[model samples]
Target: MTMPFRLTVLSLAVAATLAGCNRDKADETTPPPAASAGTGAVVTPADAAAPMAFESKTAFAEVSLTLPVAIKAQPDLHARLYAAAVRDLREFSEGAQADRTEAGGDEGLGAYDKSIEITPGAETGKLFSLVRTDSEYTGGAHPNSSFAAILWDKALKREVAAADLFTRTGDLSALDIALCAAINAEKKKRDPQAETVSLTGSDMWKCPRAALVPFVLAQGTRPGKAGGLVFLIGPYLVGPYVEGSYEVTVPQSAFRSLLAPAYADEFAGEPKPEHAGA
Candidate 1:
């Protein structure tokens, strides 16, 4: 009885193997179906998520948001960033359309464009710092550009604002002074004829409050550590629109004591040479 059962199993296995081989042979000879005329192009996940432009007789608008490859490697972070970009683009496009309608321009309004690019700052074991620059034009005399910082916690998989990394008792006044000095120096270098503005002045030309400005972590000589902070001062913040934007970097040594205990170790050394004055 046992021998008969074993023989039956062997016969079934051989039959299955022969059937699989026949299918493979048939598949080899069978030509794959051609893609539909309009569907021939392949779209990757990133390509599918690319920002779309809005064009109409009344208005034309477009947005471009770019992220670093490293940031895109994280699924949750990538999705959040992409969703936010899409939302912003959508809002801007809608607003442009509405403005055109309100203006009642038969020839259509001017085009609106917004471009955002995110670059890597410092990528450590526990944190990833990024800098985002935004250039936008919305019926203004000239396009305006600004900067923003995004700090992501690897363990928590979420964004951590720069303000949260400091202690409650941290003395940011010193950092402010440093930033003010740097701005004045850069201003002097750019236009020797132009006079440097006072930090105590209550005008647009006065030095901007460091805490209020957007800042990103600067890369340090030591691997896996932040060298310092780079304050992003947009036009009209610290000076006239003609002065444009400024990237002032303050070394970590200047703000070492101001950092919270948990974040102190994340910073070390000085700003890389390439990022020093620029």
Candidate 2:
């Protein structure tokens, strides 16, 4: 069955080392193409300027990673995020290979696939946000997709965890309540029969806590101001996998008081119309 795979941010130095090791392995496994006669430059068949930072194909698996131009513009952010994605892809590829070997090629397994894309989000003041969506199928009954949020601090030139934006690192209860309400609203819209449950409820349909969910900053009509937060809730969190994922948005006014003093002003105005309750 499909399952969630969490992605964590890694240090730039560590990512660089891991990338170097992977490069060495690739060189050993695949030989380079011949160079042009007149220019004396290597001519690779694949487009060198493609957005894909990494790609691999084998009998067991096919993996690829793509980063947006906005992300690539920030060298430090790009290196750390790319490194983490590459590491996950390698782990998945290795595990698939091992499983294939154990099965002895009798199970009629198809080649597993994984694709990760980093899309640019809103840029509010000193904080810029990006969303990473991962889709994979490793011999599962069906494919699974998950999301992660990357908050980059332009002033500090480093990545910021969502928890760091608040005073209390534990849980933002106010934000949690707002998220629950927003999700329930979306549920009712999708399925009129779907019951709206509270966080205190014990049923599987109960709303998930905001602190545990991934979120990206939403862009508003006003320039350099955040519309609000768009919490990314995966399947099975509130409903069955067949229902798919949910993107519930909580407006800035909903939990503005919960934000840390430093980030209070960063969020203002209403979320763009298109992403109001998405």
Candidate 3:
């Protein structure tokens, strides 16, 4: 009985192989690869998930000041102000990168990989950004978008204030570390008992998809010499992991000469003009 059953199985296998061979020979045409369901795009997941990394090792020149001799004479204050500006810009850009990572920004090249620069001018500041400009929608909307865009400032002091976010350390880049720390601090301030918000979604705690960090410093007048002002900087993230935000403050006082106006906006929803390139 066992031998008969084995023979029957072998015969069936041979018949199936012969049938497949016959079908292949009968097919005179080969179909093209199927397009994406919604996009009709031919690219595959491997094409979209390619790794991307950016770095700037060379430091751009110091920010050119538009202030008169009086403001320029205060070297210490000038240095501080310039440093603050660099720090703020670095933090802002890092937050942008983090947002992409949280949202799996690589879904499109336009939103994921980009560069933003800050240039100081005679009066106002300048911003420049370079990124993949392609965008497409599946709902039969705009297709085959712009290839690239060159955004520039019309009335700024310079083109962009340049700084180095890349560091030799293996850990997070300077900007990334600064943003993460700042956001962590802000959350602690809000809820002392909460845990470090991870990249998971939960009640009372969902991973924040959009987060921002703001740092503002100021100088004040003193009786004899200009005293240092306040040093306020913190980070906050908002997304699917967490609903609220967090902050960390490094409060200290320095000479008034060590102050410069650092303009950095820390909002989650607003689109930045840096990449817009007007």
Score candidate 2 by lDDT: 0.79
Error of 1 at 70 (Å): 2.3
Q: Tens-digit lDDT track for model 1 on 1-278?
A: 01255877787777677768797564443335543436776544443453222222224577777777777555566666767766776787788777766877526456788777878876766778778788888865899888888888877777887777788885689888888888888898899876677769966578877778888788788888888887888888777888888888888888788888878888888788966753
Judge candidate 1 against the unseen true structure and give its global Cα lDDT, from 0 to 1: 0.74
Please name the candidate that would achieve the greatest lDDT relative to the true structure: 2
* 157-202: candidate 2 lDDT, tens digit per residue: 7777888877775658888888888988889899989878788898
Q: Which ten residues in a row have the lowest lDDT in candidate 2?
A: 1-10
Between prediction 1 and prediction 3, which has the larger TM-score?
Answer: 1
| lDDT of each residue in 146-190, candidate 3, tens digit only | 222122222332222212111223232333333344445555656
lDDT of each: 0.74, 0.79, 0.31
RMSD of 3: 25.6
Poorest 10 consecutive residues of model 1 by lDDT? Answer: 50-59
lDDT for 203 in candidate 1 is: 61
TM-score, structure 3 vs. true: 0.21
Quote each prediction's TM-score: 0.76, 0.79, 0.21
Candidate 1 root-mean-square deviation in Å: 11.1
- How should the candidates be ordered by TM-score, best one leading? 2, 1, 3
- lDDT of model number 3: 0.31
For every model shown, the clashing-pair count is 0, 1, 35
